[model samples]
Target: MATTTNDTTYTESELEAEKTAGSRSALAMARRGAFYLSLGLAAAMTVLFLPDLLALLVMGWTAEAGAELGIHRLHVMGIAAVVGAFLLGLFVQAYKPRERIASMWGAFLVILTASVGTVWFGVGRPEEVLPFLAVTGIALVAHPAGRRLLRRGNSYSPALLGLVAVAAIPILAFAATQLSMSSSTVDPHALDGHYVMMTALLIAPIAYGLFAALGFDGWRLASWFAALPIAYYGLLSIAFPAQVGSTGAMWGVAAICWAIAFVAVAEYSRTETSSMLRREVGHSS
Candidate 1:
């Protein structure tokens, strides 16, 4: 009879403990979601206002409120906010992830996939030579053969490190091409998108590469800066397609980058929570 009572008491205690743990976990997730939502709002507000603020300053200098310059024309600014939110989200949410260099697969995959799409679309054009080179360079880094070279003790295998460096050359050149605004110089498309493509496509990939190479420290803020702005920019391309240059391709890159980063961040959070639970179990045992 005593043993039966003791067993019931222990079972009740276990249930209570589980309930507490579950509550804590749910609260933590809720708090995290709220924080990201707040950051998203902040980003959106900044994008909506900052450019107009700049325009206000310019107007102060010239004393002209040109019809072309106003807060309402903040399509790119909205996109910038998404970039901020995305970057900051990663830093906060990716508190703990798998230690393996394999965690960076998403980082390299980002550029690799985009470059492949570019090559596929522009294969016959002489202008696509740079993107073609970039496709080769990125493929070397993202392919399984390159990842297989990563050693157990090393942060990055020598071969993988070397490939990343070699890959940088072509990628950098491709980014330069994206930012050169040549399309605008000849056809005037830059003014329409306001370098949204430059920030999202050209800058974010480089930031991710740096983040991965640096072992995800010291360069986090940069990664955030590269990421968060693209959401709004990507939206603009979809909503106002006629206004954005290379609209379809640019949208694809933005979507893929955002999705990959989000998945990485979520994985990090899940791993962290699992580790915490394990530690707690160990302590109790």
Candidate 2:
């Protein structure tokens, strides 16, 4: 009778331990979900602000907003960029960060700094000071939430979801741009420059999706290529500032795409590279 009682007790203890471990894992996953969601929110906001609706409202396809409005638009993009970066930091730092994550941060910081800085300097206004502060404050809140998600393991579901989002936006953007361009009259002379940039934006996401989903070294290289469209499109707005601004009020949407692509690709690259290296090492061992 004592032996049977001890056996039952052992069984219960093992079950209890398993339950505790499961609960901990569930909590970790929940935290990771929240962290990724925050990043998605930041990306969405940046997309909304990209086209400079107010500037487009008054400026009307001039590719440049009137002086005051232009500065205001630039301020919005700057704020979006900061928020995007902060959210990205939270996501990247959440996983088991390593050399790859460091590289990811370095690359993104440089890109965001250079790109967003231009907008900050190019069209900055004193009136936007308060707004910038407010946006920064929001990002500060998101930072901690993301930090809480940090864990020692990795999960592909989050990466997969983020990648899906990264791919879907551009695909939609491509359709929207095409539709807009079809109905709107772009100057014949300017068509050449516009087509080149738009074509890249159209093709990039498809390529990003293809290689990212295919997995392997291809996945590791996805972000580097994913960045191509954003880098291409973002600059075109500045380069042909007159052109994008003139096209429509939706220019800000492209900027949002830029932010999403940047972070998505950076994170994807880091994770994929780490996974590949570990596999390679395991095989070699």
Candidate 3:
């Protein structure tokens, strides 16, 4: 009778432990899901507003409001709030590497410098449009840094890394070309060709990189998210042919698409890794 009683106790204890483990696993999965969702939302927002953001930056060159107030205090404040919230969400979802954060900050600083340069040199020092060159230069430098931080300790996936590098190069090059030409005396029609060329250059590589990262699931989600910007740019190109002639709008659209694609791929890869870890845990148990 005592042995039977002891057996009963052992069974109950094991059941309790299993239940606790299951609960913890559920919570962890939930957290990961939330993180992916947050990332997706942030990327989507970036895509939706990117055209306007670029427009604002370009207009900052000519608009009195941009020159005097700097990106309109309200827009700047809004972007800040959005970026803060996105970063906070990402932090809550995962323990990101310090290098990844550094890379992100580096990119932000470069972009900010370019925006400020647009306003400062708009009228007074058109030659200073050269400062805008830093945007792509910084991004090119930061991409490797970010990849290094992200891939640290993990077995290197050469194909994936290569894809990312390939996608980024065109973007950086296009941005540099645009910056260089912005200072020249090119006609609007010619400038439009530059914009179209840059956009065309980015589309295939960025899509491929995202596919490698996310696999089919990620590609599907990212593709749906990517469509919005493509449509927006299509309309903008058609409606305001003269105003949207610059490469600025095209680059902005491509950046938005790539950003969303990258985030989607990252989330999918993270989830796959987590799943593998969980399987290892289960096998050990």
Question: Model 3: per-residue lDDT, tens digit, 1-285?
Answer: 122444464466677787899997786566455434544554454566444534443353455644564423222322332233223322322233233333333233333443443443342222322332343333333333333423323222233444466556865675455445544345442232333222332333343343333232223233333333333333333433344322345554655565555445444555565432212312332
- TM-score per model over all chains: 0.33, 0.31, 0.32
Q: Against the true structure, whose TM-score is highest? A: 1
lDDT tens string, model 2, 1-285? 122444464466677787899998887676556545644554555465534533342343254543444533432332333333333333353344332232233223333333333233332222332233334334333333344312212223234435547656755665455434422244431232232223323444443434333332224434444454444345435544553322323554565465465556446555565542223322332
lDDT of each: 0.39, 0.40, 0.39
Candidates 2 and 3 compared: the better one by TM-score is: 3
* Colliding residue pairs in candidate 1: 79-229, 79-232, 79-233, 82-228, 82-229, 83-227, 83-228, 83-229, 84-228, 87-224
- The per-residue C-alpha lDDT of model 3 at residue 36 equals 48
Which parts of model 1 are misplaced by more than 4 Å? 1-75, 78-177, 183-201, 216-226, 253-285
For model 1, residues 1-285, the per-residue Cα lDDT tens digits are 122444464466677787899997786566555534543544454465444543442242242433353432333333334233332423232333233233233333443433443343332122322332343333334333233424322221222233235535744665566556533544333434334333334444444434443333322333344334344345445544544333554654654456356335433533454432112312332
- What local lDDT does model 3 show for residue 24? 78
Off by over 4 Å in 3: 1-104, 112-160, 184-242, 245-260, 273-285
Q: Which stretches of candidate 2 lie over 4 Å from their true place?
A: 1-16, 47-221, 224-285
Root-mean-square deviation per candidate: 18.2, 14.4, 14.2
In model 2, pairs of residues that clash are 50-251, 50-252, 51-251, 51-252, 51-253, 61-246, 63-242, 63-246
